[model samples]
Target chain A: MSSVVIVGAGLGGLRAAEALRANGFTGTITVVGDEVHLPYNRPPLSKEALAGGVDVPGLEFRRKASIEDVDWRLGSAAVSSDLAERTVTLADGTTLAFDGLVVASGIRPRRLPIPGPQEGRHVLRTAADAHAVRDRLRPGTHVLIMGAGFIGCETAATARALGAEVAIVAIDEQPMVRPLGAELGAGMRRRHEEHGVRFHLGHSIDSFVGDDHVQVAVLSDGTELPADVVIEAVGSVANVEWLAGNDLDLSDGLLTDSAMQVATSSAPVVAVGDIARHPNALFGSVARRIEHWNMPTETGRRAGATLAALLAGDEPDRGPFCAMPSFWSDQYHHKLQSFGMPGIADRIELVEGSVDGPCIVEYHDASGLVGVVGVDRTQELAPYRKQLAARAG
Target chain B: MTVKVFVDMDKCQHYGQCCFEASDVFELDEDGKLQYVAEADESRRDDIESAADVCPMQAISVE
Candidate 1:
């Protein structure tokens, strides 16, 4: 009987496993993971879970009742891969052979290189990270958050919701300026201000001051703000160090074709989720890497189904996966959803609704066929998604 | 019998809701990467189809 060995039990890996079973593969499957707990969701870690409204059990993808059958090798990490031998080497000195392999090792949150006082600083990346931050959220606690990215904004919202005074200091002209562009970010800035979240735009943190009891946040311009806690949400780095000597494309992640196959024709390993970067046909050779919750499931499903067909000696007819990229942020009472990439929007054209209520904002690029961005209008996003798919062809 | 399934790693972020829809094949590693048992038996077709259906990105395709 043919056996499949998978590495990294993250969202991508789990989806592949489920896809394979759904596709009707009966071979023995072994899942090796580095985390002690089973595969869970991460989006909630920054929202409801961080706000103290939801618990870990409620956020788990696999409940206790459904974890039967299949071999789950928890707390195991894959250290190396051999393309010629078709083997995966784990950190515990075990070798596992595979007819097919899927590499789903995701990225880890970036941190400050120099170690400062580790008392109040927090970075929300996993369930453990969220739980730690939750413990620090007390009434009247002034929190200082670095970076105006999605996680940072969500943390600010969560902190404010917890009745803690929150202040965001970012280096950009506005929060989310890079990803969401300046105009939309201006809207977000106003939204945050309305919620009582203070913003120090176009500034960097000079240093952390004082010992508890509302420390001061020294800014680049010599301005000082008082805070009891600090949260950092700069960004993340892909876990591709293991493939250094292996000769795989590792610019941002393991480079693969649309099929998610790593290396050239000489090698045939599957790469999925955050650790895989490839030129998106829809985005025109953008070579993007998606680190959201929805992307992994789609990629894993395709990888799993493709692997099943290949193992069965059938011609795999899987096409390059493309979709309107969408993600949601639950901040205060407003649920912000941004669909498609709005990286090149000259201006944000409010098509329908209002930011005060559920609204839809369209971002138009030079070409003008909706280059990216459909805000708050999920149902209206269907047209743009279709347009992007058609353009991909 | 053969089927069609596609995975665009660039578009996939690796959240495993598909495992719930079809656990016979999808599994995650200790590092949260996606791993799977390909070549599933025919009896499991319904589950695999369900996973492809529920995939948020529609990154999954069945033929």
Candidate 2:
């Protein structure tokens, strides 16, 4: 019987396992994860989980009894991999051989270089991190969020919802401008401002100051703000360090073909989710790493299908795997949804409603409409997304 | 055959992602609350399953 070893028991890893069974792969499957918790949803960590509205156990993707017949190596991280030997070494120094390997280790939260005790400084990537941040979000507590990215903005909204005074500091002219464009970002900024969240845009963090925990953040403009807690939502780094010393390209993420097959491995190895950087035909075949919520599901399906076919001694459908990327964020009753690659658009227009009100924004590049962003207008997004997908094809 | 759907309201955030996946089955009312057909045609099983898969909260299940 063939054996498959999957690293990172997150959404991608778990979904791939399900797909393996769905594809009739009657083989031994082992899922290794660093976290003790079973595969849980990460999207709620910044919103409902951080606001203390949901318990950690409720975030699990499925109940333990539903996981089926898979060797689960929880709380053990993959320390290294030997591609030639088709084996993986875990942090506990256990080695496992496999006929198929799926690398879905995902990314870790990026940290700030500022000097301060790590007691109160937080980054929301895990369930424990969200609980820690939630515990500190007492009413009137001042929070200094050091990035205007999705995680930062969503956390800001949650913090404010919890009655904490939140201030966002970022170098962008407006929060989320690089991805959502200036107009939408400005609109989102206005919404946050209306909710009493402060913004210090176009400013960089100089350093964090406190004895045992961050209490004050000094900006590069020499402006000092008193903060009870500081959150570093800068971004994330792909967990590809273990793939080092191997021939695999570890420049950005694990470089993979369009089908998510590892480029350097002769063995049947594939990657999925945030750690897999592959050519996206939607963006003119540009190799990019998508860290959105839906990526793991879409890519996991593809990777699992491909690996199962290879193990079954069959030729996998090697079509370009391009699924319309969609992501949604809920903040203080406002639902923000985006479809497609908005960052690459050259022009953006408000197709429906006004900037100050709930709206649908259309993003267009030279090739025409490439993306659509809707705020509290989910029903109006479908046709635009269909058209965008058709155009991409 | 009809597919039976169950949504754990405690886990559901009513994000409306399921609505996009299975438009004929899942709908978000004007108040932004999720309403769905308890018994959907088996033809929509794929769509309903996709809805369950795309749910960020993992609150939806089909049988």
Candidate 3:
């Protein structure tokens, strides 16, 4: 194989390129991304960057020396692909052929189709979005967040820290209910409330009312929230449009085997990062697209090895990919960290400390311990992470 | 061969993610602050590089 093209210039793309080189694949690599900037740390965009300010250069990922020669085609997106011809057409009308393809297009923030003026509504994803939202956040401003997810809750905390009034309206009973569970999630909501953030739980924003900018957020319960800005942190949509017409499972995301090889692809196509719904042996045979920050590094390593092997006309490792998914969230001074899929657990027990302060929560399914969350106990999470990462034969 | 490893004290968030990759080279102190060896055998380069890569703050540097 002489060439490889990686779609999406995020952390995943950078790692994939680095891995390709590390695996002794001396092919020319080109990364195509819609965003003009290279891969940057995005988790800070909601916390420090949101409250302090957005700095694209400061947030950019540090590339290893191995991938320095990789071509970066920024500012244009991959419009479509022809799997049979091994060609990808970019938005700039350039068609590029590759011996191996890395489907790392990642995801975009999903916007709700609510009746509202688009003007003051925003979603936190890119550097530009963070900067734009930060510019509007100040004292006397009211930010009505429309989702109770981590992003929404973090934005509430950041907005509140900026001296802006923050109100969260969501359909869930508590903030971060999906991952932290109702009990612990409620604890999180209380922490946010203690910091001057208001929660209108079990409510949805009916619409945003104003002539130009959002002036009021009408909740389903008929409570109208005065809003200077509305942040919709509902979820994300996989950027799989470019892979359309290809005979691949683009249902939720690009379905891949445990080896990161695209399922039933016409060529040596491998999907990685957030876009690949691959199974983990540690979690069972169920393929899940974990949106955690570490998934890109884990999947990219495996995908790069798989693609490099396939390009070399060699068989790839059939070993089960059992990466322990993890993510962290900072709201105010409290830091919440998790290892594995706590959302999949049916039972949870507070193993140490109280919910109001430093604590370690263990999540379990009928099988056994499936996840662990550490609240301000970062040092103690390593053992639990290793436990979740242990693969069962 | 020996490699020099450095962690920017100012930029480090002490998330302890690097400990998982190169526990021998990087570890959090009792106060949950990051402490790492400045120089190590080159055989540990792979582990040190992985530790640097996984750092969320991008505060680790190896030479």
Candidate 4:
């Protein structure tokens, strides 16, 4: 029987495995990952989970009642992979050979690199990290957040909801300015400040102080604020170190074609999730690598099918996996939904709804109508999904 | 037979919805990262395709 080996047991990896099975492949399939826990939902990590309202199991996409049959090599890290030999070598010195190889290894959180930074310093990428931050969220505790991105905002909302005094230190003039652009980003900043989160904008972090209690956060502007707890939601880096010596075209990530096939070497390999940087025909030939939740899950499934076809001696004929990039965050009592791709929004207009009630913000690139950001209004963003898809076609 | 599959790990958040849809190909490791068979038999294409259709990032690209 043929064997298929996958690295990284993330949403993309798991979905790719399931796709192989559903495609009727009766092969020896093996999955390898580095985490010690079963795959759980990450979106809730900053929302309900941090609020102490949901347990880990409740966030699991696969319930215990509906487990799948596969060689689950859990807690094993994939140290290196040979694209030529089609084998994945685990950290334990075991190697799994495969007829096909999929690199679904996701990203790792980027932490603050500074002196005296140790435990108690946190990043909210996983469930455990969220729990740690939640434990520190006692009423009246002072919380200092680094970065004013989506994660930082969500963390601030969670902390405020738990009655913690929250402060955000961002390098950007406005929160989400890079992603949502300046105008809409300013609106998001106002929303947070209105809810009582202190903001120190356009400043860089100097260092985190204290040996045990994390008492001070020093900024480049020479401002030191007393902080009871500090959470770093700065950003993330692609986990592509394994391909350092390999011939793969590793720009910011694994360079791939629209079909998600790695555009390097004669060996057949594909990359997905945050580790992939591929071109999208929809956005002025822009290459994108999105770290959101849903994108990888869908990509993994599609890649699995494409791989199945290649193995069957059939020509892979799948089109570019293009879906309007969308993400939502549950912060405080607000449900913020961002639809389409806002990476290149040159202008944002308040077309419908209101910031006082349900609101929608449409972003137009030079080509018109590229993205939309909605507040307390998911339905308003639904219609644009089809429109975006049509634009891609 | 050899097949090529692509996964954008940056887009994948380790959620395990794909495992339920195509167990033969996808599984969750103990660490909770999603793992999958890199290749599959030709007959299982439809199911794997469906799994990809459901991915949130459109992270999967097949050739």
Evaluated with lDDT, which candidate comes out highest? 3
Candidates, ranked, DockQ: 3, 2, 4, 1
Error of 3 at A337 (Å): 1.1
**lDDT score of residue A291 within candidate 3:** 93
Residue-level error in angstroms, candidate 1, position A92? 3.8
lDDT of 1 by residue, B1-63 (tens): 644445555434454435556666765455444455556667777677767645543445444
Model 2, runs deviating above 4 Å: A63-67, B9-15, B28-33
Error of 2 at A61 (Å): 0.7
Off by over 4 Å in 3: A391-393
Displacement of the residue A304 alpha carbon in candidate 3, Å:
0.4
lDDT of 3 at A312: 92
Error of 3 at A272 (Å): 1.1
Model 2, residue A132: what's the lDDT? 77
Q: What is the interface RMSD of candidate 1, in Å?
A: 11.8
DockQ of every model listed? 0.06, 0.52, 0.74, 0.09
Which candidate tops TM-score?
3
Tens digit of lDDT per residue, candidate 1, span A107-174? 88887642234567778877777887898898898899988998999889888888999899888898
Model 4, residue A259: displacement in angstroms? 1.8
lDDT, residue A97, model 4:
80
In model 2, what lDDT does residue A116 have? 55
Root-mean-square deviation of candidate 1: 8.7
